[model samples]
Target chain A: MQALSFEQAPPPSVPIRFFLTAPLFMLLAGLLLLIDGEAVMASRWTPAALALTHLMTAGFMLQVMLGALFQLMPVAAGANLWRPSVLALPVHLLSAIGAVLLVAAFHHQIAWAYQLAVVAIGCSVLAFVPAGMLALSRPPGTSHSLIALRIALLAFFATVLAGATMALARAGLIDTGWLRFSSSHVALGLAGWGCVLVAAVGYLVVPMFQLTPAYPRWFARSFAPLMVLAIGLGMVVLHPTAWLPLIGLVALFASVTLDRQQRRRRAKLDATFRFWRFAMGCVLFACAGSVLMIFNIGGNAVALAVGVLAILGGFVSVISGMLYKIVPFILWLYLQPRVQGVPPMTRMLNEQWVLWHLRAHVAMIGAALLATLWWPAVYLVGSLMVVSAALLGGQLLRVVGRARAALRLAQPS
Target chain B: MTDRLPPIVVDARRLLPPEPMERTLEALDEMQPGQEVLLMIPRQPAPLFDMLHNNGYAYTVESQPDGVFHITIRQASGD
Candidate 1:
């Protein structure tokens, strides 16, 4: 008696497609929140800000971050992802449902949205922590970006907890700022998860595709946590009321160094570089403004605006721009060849198409910063964000479509 | 003539650079003429072969039921 066995077939790039599109969805969410910019900025309509903002942070940003980790960690740690296919559905559903409900509650005046957000974000965080740890558990391969991500994941979890705390507090569950946990959450989220992770990814991806050398190892390693430590001390030490200023200085230095390195890179010197410049300038100017504020130079609101603008407009812009290249590259590698493979992911998609998105993201970043200063620019910035997200999302969906086609051809009926 | 060919079987999966197989093929492009290469890949690596072929590389794809994909390359003599 003989038995026949069937072979399992896999599609390479569907997850990458999701990673690329989810951010576009988030960008659109940010644009919607900006529709009522001044009020949201002033906290008059916190719901709009919280909802729209988290969509960017959680929906747009974290979505890609988590997806990329899944893809990259396997390579970086020299270990296969545990439960790779099995993990996607639950992770995606919980995160999506949780993010949307959380945002809707905040934006639409539903009190439960806060509760929903906590549950969803908490679950997503739970899923992400294990996955991230597992990915990093393998030996740190030579990729500086993965090493940075390994360190940044710790900060990412901190922000997630802070976010959960803020949600609970808003729901009237617990009291005490927990060391101004709300603000701490934003700092950790922006710098720790968003900034550090993006930087880590940037460190590797920039050089890999662009033919640039890695940034000085010690400098990149020291940069994030130094600012993070300063911030933590400022919050806890009380003796270091001056530490906030110190943190700003460190952040400024990091930005300037990154700007210098990007310029020195020998890659295509394309729109990606220009976007990097825009983001660096925004952060540098804001940090300088914050230092002036420390000396009691500017009005409190204006100073706050400068800092916030830097985080949202500058940092986020740089991230969005980087994604224009990165998402496509990943998709092309994972998905494009199925559509086209001898070229495989290498030249699966048009580099020129990616450049168009980079240009648009840069334009949107500038518009977003201008909107931060002027009220009317809000509508224009919002529209630009919407457009950018649309282009990016559409591109990703196309990759998924291609992946499906490749699977069919490969599966052999 | 095909039956006379020696089975090309080299476990090249580990040797392939740490990227999608297609990009790894770029390294192969630099191979010297007359280099006879045997690649053993996970069935997953079939996509890499499809791509190399699409790029106009001369290759023969044969599947063994044990799930080891055998891809043999005849070196391109620069014309």
Candidate 2:
């Protein structure tokens, strides 16, 4: 039989640059909360609230997701991203600048800011989405993770188009018809892009990192396609009820993931695993709240509560957990060849800092939920969120610094 | 370092990326003539196959029904 061969992953710097920038956005989001606490709590559609939401979704979440994808495309999917380092420089810069401009546009209602944001973020997406799709176009080997990545990329493109349309409408460059597409935008971003990507990565990492058994073939194969179909239906129907199945599928994914984590062969539980389990629990809770709201049992209060749970509790928790594992692992891997005595992956970062971050993250999520229910708690939410972001960012930077120091030591004198 | 040593076994099923790849490479580097390395991993180490071929190594892979892959690599005939 012919030998099996695949492309190597991009140099560690490509992903690490994105990783290092993500927490700054989270920090910005936290500071935004502190600056506009009362205004942010008033209404979800308010300018301040919109800015805050995008800061988390586009700024924090998308950065980390892209970074992870860069690392995974070659290693897991056997697909080579075209000149990743060269491409990532512009993509990362534009994405960061665009997120800032877009949030600033919302906060200040500046037309120029919105226009510039459209150009910058539009360029970033144009660069990233197509490159990613092309890599997956004919991957060397077929796996559930690769398929899921493809589906998520398509969803990400659709989400970006919808968001750009909405931005144009807000800028008075388009008619109000685009405004009606808001719900579709949220569905595409959260369900289509965010949850599907997470599910895809979870399929690969949950088993590999946690020493758990492979996810059932049936579930791994079908989940993303079903989610894509549900998202398509929801977009066409243009009603909240259409999202019912999509949410149901996410909850099922979470349930199965938690079940698998429970069956992990490794008995020693770490903070990353805790973060994952907690995130799964949050997803379930979010879905339940979504169901209640869709059936008209609860009003805007319930909707806000659900958003908080999904965005903060579910997505942030999972991303933080992954960062804890992925960052240190990458550092350890990159340092292995250059350094004579490289440390274990676990030694790249201080476990105490990770555990501390986890505790603070939990507190931040709780405070966020409380703030959703009662506006008075926004201050607590803001403070805890700032601390959580700082803690997570500090840990990541420390690991990178350690890796650099090792590289320096290994250099020939 | 003896040529008659049993093939060194590297079980990488539970480990994540770079670990499996790293261990496999290390085993190949230390392999003596007529010695082999047996790798037990969850997925096909496709990238490694190319590296080995470029370096004039011979290998065979067996895919288990349960999705695990068993790969055996040895040095090509002569120096």
Mark the regions of model 1 whose C-alpha exceeds 4 Å error after superposition: A1-14, A30-35, A41-45, A140-147, A176-179, A224-228, A239-267, A292-297, A300-312, A331-356, A406-412, B1-79
**Which candidate tops DockQ?**
2
Question: Per-candidate TM-score, first chain only?
Answer: 0.82, 0.97
**For residues B6-74, could you state the per-residue lDDT of candidate 2 as single tens digits?**
998999976765578678878887887788899998766665676678778889989998767899899
Q: Residue B9 of candidate 2: its Cα lDDT?
A: 95
Per-residue lDDT tens digits of candidate 2, residues A304-330?
A: 778888999899999999998888877
Give the alpha-carbon lDDT of every model.
Answer: 0.59, 0.85
Q: In angstroms, give how far residue A167 of model 1 lies from its true place.
A: 1.1
Per-chain TM-score of chain A in candidate 2 equals 0.97
User: Going through the candidates in order, what fraction of the true interface contacts does each contain?
Assistant: 0.06, 0.40
Candidate 2, superposed: residue stretches over 4 Å from native: A1-7, A140-142, B1-79
Give the candidate number with the greatest TM-score: 2
lDDT of model number 2:
0.85
